[model samples]
Target: MASKLGVSIVAVLATSVGVMLALALGLISLSIAAGIFLVLLVAMLVFHGAAMDFTSGLSDSEAFQKAVEEKEQREAEHEEWEKEYWGEHHPDYQGEEHH
Candidate 1:
């Protein structure tokens, strides 16, 4: 896992790059680009929690383990949902052809 500080910095830099790319590509107006950057920065802050300093923490705690399990479950559920949705909506879906 990456340190929180490193992730935070990457998030900020990525957002900046995204905004600049969008503007340069004429995908968004300057105002909308700024809004996008602001939204992404706020999302990063929320997703990363309020910790400003990165410290080596124990990953063996029950809470940490449970959180990881929950995250994995959510990802699995999302993957299933995507498969189902695409299978229903896509014409070229292989599973549907087999059925």
Candidate 2:
């Protein structure tokens, strides 16, 4: 959304201004400022992608929906496996409903 993009832009500008001020005041060395800027830039890029993807709505995409279903299926399978393993290894183990 436009609002999310605006927020991301404002955050980047604020960070840049803060870093520049710190460099100008000699509170931090040029190398440190550059390193901080680069790290922030990388983080922004990574998070921007995630923000955009989430804002755009993954439910609109069939592939994303399929992936979600697959994940749920896998988790259910894992739960079944755990139930079986615990039942076989523990004499006093009861089903989940008993808990």
Candidate 3:
């Protein structure tokens, strides 16, 4: 989804420029070029904003690694707790191993 948006943003920018130049050079009628240019310009703006938001949310390597490690640790702890609770409450749940 992100890649597609990025590609469309690039395409919009290129098309807008091309259309504007085409109109300026009198190679195409202004009315048709204007509509296409305006649409692409808006798309380019929206995608550019989205790209900025995506980039802003990115973290550095150490931070990302720490986040992943913490997530894994939390998951393991949760699984352990679930096993303890389920072992007492539903020991015969599919013949799970427990005291």
Q: Top model by lDDT, which number?
A: 2
Candidate 2 local accuracy as lDDT?
Answer: 0.84
- Write the residue-wise lDDT of candidate 2 on 13-93 in tens digits: 999999999999999999999999999889888988888777776555776788889999999998888778888887577
Off by over 4 Å in 3: 1-18, 60-63, 90-99
lDDT of 3: 0.78
Estimate every model's Cα lDDT from 0 to 1: 0.74, 0.84, 0.78
Better of 1 and 3 by TM-score: 3
Candidate 1 Cα deviation (angstroms), residue 59: 14
Q: How close is every model to the real structure, measured as TM-score? A: 0.40, 0.52, 0.47
Which candidate ranks first by TM-score, i.e. highest?
2
Candidate 1 vs candidate 2: the TM-score winner is 2
Q: Tens digits of per-residue lDDT for model 3 on 6-74?
A: 688677768877887898899999789978867776777887887777677755686789999999999
lDDT-based ranking, best first? 2, 3, 1
Give per-residue CA lDDT, model 1, range 3-93, as digits (tens).
7568878878887897899899998998998788788878777756645222234445766899899999998897777778878888566
